[model samples]
Target: MKKRLRDLGEDALIARLLRGFPGGENLRVGPGDDCAVVDPGRGLLRLLKTDAIVEGVHFLPDTPAAKVGWKAVARVLSDFAAMGGVPEHLLVTVAVDPAKPVAWMDGLYRGIRKCLATHGGVLAGGETSRLPSGAMISVAGEGRVERKHLILRSGGKPGDLVVVTGRLGGSIRGKHLTFTPRLNEAAWLVRNLRPSAMMDLSDGLAKDLPRLAEASGCGFEFGEVPATRGCTRAQALGDGEDYELLFTVSPRRWIAAAGQWPKDFPQLSIIGRLCPPGQGASLAGGWDHFSP
Candidate 1:
């Protein structure tokens, strides 16, 4: 029997498909991290990211098309935030049934424009396609960050204290559609804390934390994860689409960093530590694209 994607899971499938792709001298980072980093010369590093939202997978049939559009754009922006980059331009591709209302498309674009205006980006262009069933929106964008500010998932070190911005869980209770991307919080961290490593939490802490640790070639030891007001610790760890920032700092630096955290932003919580691979306990289960 042929090997199935469900068996391999999303991460392993991605690794398998991207294996042996040639890297150019200008490709600073590729594939595995939140955004692909390119050295565009000068002092700037170009960030490239693309994200998609499907009607059934991301939003319900009655969910506002505008919110869906906002999510599509915001998701990419979150990735840019993870890389400490500022979005400059975007290209949006929309796939929907031809029978869908024109008003829906209008609402979607309105949300897209609003998101770009709020977060800083231009809707350069995009494509439209006919889908047999539900709607899908995909946004691809480019951003820029200075070399000094660039953060990658692989930069973490053992003994680094793991921190997360904002509360987690309860996304299904409407936060998923409305939560703000952590652009400002990330900017603050880059300027003030300079986390040893960072990434946005889209796939739940249980899933994404391991990815970050694996990328950094370390293992993680976690204690408390802050849950949303009506959520439990398990939900906080397993509920995907939190859209908060997950980052690491040196244990010695965490005290000062925590003390300097801005009052305007959402709360930051100390959830864990990154330890040498063999010494840390393992976590199991979260959101997986092909897993049942």
Candidate 2:
């Protein structure tokens, strides 16, 4: 008998199924990074990202269709933000129930267009299809980054200060559907400081922090977590979809950036330090798709 998807789990499934996908010569970074990075033959690099949002799995059927559209594209844009890039073009695939109202689909695309426009991205066209059960969205986007500003998840070193932009947790209350991608803030970070490593917090800090540590072959020590109001510490750590930037920087850079950090930007918190391999690092809480 075939093994169930849950038996494989999200991480295992991604590793097993996508481990061998062929990457072209221009591909600088492939699977495992927030976005695939490619050298476009210029001083600038192109970042490619694809993400899916499923009905019921990611949102309620009753959720506003406009919000649904906003989330579908924003998810991928956040990946660009994680790498300190700016979104330039987008392609969306919408799979919708046949019985859904035409107005609903219109609102969805309208919201998508509005968001792409706000973020200086173009709706470069897409495909649509009918699904038997519920609506699903697939977004494939491209962004550009200056070579000097490009940040990756594997650049972390021991002694780097771990930091997070904005608050975390409680996304299920409604933030997930409408949060803005941290494009400006991430760009600012790269322009001023060389982040040792960076990633977006989609899978919660508990799950994502471990990923950073493992990728960099290191561990970390936790400090005060900047949890969203009304959220318990555990909820802050485990509840996924915060859409914030979690990054590492050298202590010297932190002191310099801290002094000149934009007061108008979202709050920044120094949450910990990366440790050398073999040291204990907290991996206490996070979401697992296969888990109940």
Candidate 3:
């Protein structure tokens, strides 16, 4: 019989599953990373990403309709932020059970509208379908970055400084519900310093950083990670949903911008450096879809 994930727990299960997967040419980073990376070409790249949130899988049945809607949009926006791209438009598709009330659907749309307005994202177009199961929300976002300025997981070189835009862990408290998108910061980074490599912390850095290293053909060494208030070291390393930017820069540029970066935003920090790839990406913690 196939073993259930809960039998092995989150970390062991992910290790086993990822062990069998192979990397692809277009994929600078694959399933084990913060986010998957694909190279579209050299100049003026388009970033297209989509995420789905299901009623029971992603959120509770009683989750506020508006919050659910916001999350759907925010999740895609977060991916754009990771790439340091400017979000221009989005297409949202929703599926709801026939029994769900019309007002609930209205509330969901209202939440989506609020997020779009906040992020300066234009609602392009999408479709709706009836679901026999429960509600499902999927959002596709379109963003653009100058060819030279686009950041990828493969850009980090050995000895480059690792930096993060915000604190980590315990997002379940309330931060996950109302976290900001980091749109402005991404723009600033792309325009000004231009990180060597960049991605957002959707999955824990322990899992994601290794992916970045693999893409860049390097490894990493962490000195200290900036922890969120009330977060443990393990939590800081493994907890997901921080939605903060993780990037790399030249050591010299990081020193020059260190003073200036804080003036504009309060959450930035340098966490580690890149090294040559050795063993596969090693994380202190891991997440698994099938594991508990």
Candidate 4:
């Protein structure tokens, strides 16, 4: 039997697809990261990321077009935040059935502009194509981070303390549409706490934490899973779509970092700690694109 995407799962399929892709010296970080980091021959590092939202998968048919647009752009911005970068420019590709109304498109543009205004970036340009079935919106983004402050998922140490911003899970209860990307918090972290590794929690802690541990060549032991009010711990671990920041800081600095968390954002939590590989408990289940 031939192997399909469902057989390999999203991460494995991605690995198989990009197995032989070449990387240049300028490529600071490529696939398997929140965003691609590139040396643009300047003082700063360039960050590149692309993300998409589909009609049925990401949103229902009756979901607000404006929310969909915001999510498409915000998703890319979240990746930039994971890298401790700033979004600069964006290009969007929109595909929808020919019958989609001009008003809907206008609403989407409004949401896009609003997200950029709230976050940081501009809609440089984009392309539009007709779709025979449902709608899909893709956003490509460029961002910048100072060389000294760039964060990657592979930088965690075995003893680092893991932290997360904001409560997790319960996104399906409408938080997904309005969740804020932790850009400002990330900036503060790099400036002060200086986390060793960082990534946004899009695929839930269950799926994403393991990726970080594997990348950093470590394992993780859970402390307390922080779920949103009314959500169970299981939901906090496995219910994807929580666009919060999950990061690791040196154990020595974890205390000061926790003490100095800004008052504006009140949901910082110490969720876990990294351990030596093969010494931690298991975690499984999250939103998988190809899983039955």
- Tens digit per residue, CA lDDT, model 1, 1-292: 8977888899888888998889988998989899999997777899999989999999987899888888899999999999988899999999999999999999899989889889989999999999998899999999999899999999999999999988999899888987788899889889989999999999999999999999999999999889999899889999989999999999777777667777798988889999998778787777999886
Q: After superposition, how far is residue 192 of candidate 1 from its true place, in Å?
A: 0.6
Clashes (backbone N, CA, C under 3 Å), per candidate, total 0, 0, 2, 0
Name the weakest run of 10 consecutive residues (lDDT summed) in model 1: 252-261
- Candidate 4: tens digits of C-alpha lDDT, residues 51-146: 999999988888888888888888899999999999999999999998988888998988898999999898899999999988999999899999
lDDT of 2 by residue, 39-124 (tens): 97778999999999999989988999899989998899899999999998899999999999998899899879877887778989
In candidate 2, stretches whose alpha carbon ends up further than 4 angstroms from where it belongs are: none
For model 3, residues 1-292, the per-residue Cα lDDT tens digits are 8976667865456677788677776554455433344566555566667788888876777878888888888888888877777777789899989899888888888888998888878999998999987899988877776666667777888889889988888887766766787878988887777899888877678777877777789888887788888899888888877888889899888777766753668477888888777833356564545554
RMSD from true fold, candidate 1: 1.0
Colliding pairs, model 3: 44-147, 219-275
Where does candidate 1 stray beyond 4 Å?
Answer: none
- How far off is residue 91 in model 2, in Å? 0.5
Better of 1 and 2 by TM-score: 1
Worst 10 residues of 2 by lDDT: 283-292
List runs of model 3 lying over 4 Å from the truth: 1-43, 262-264, 279-281
**Number of backbone clashes in candidate 2:** 0
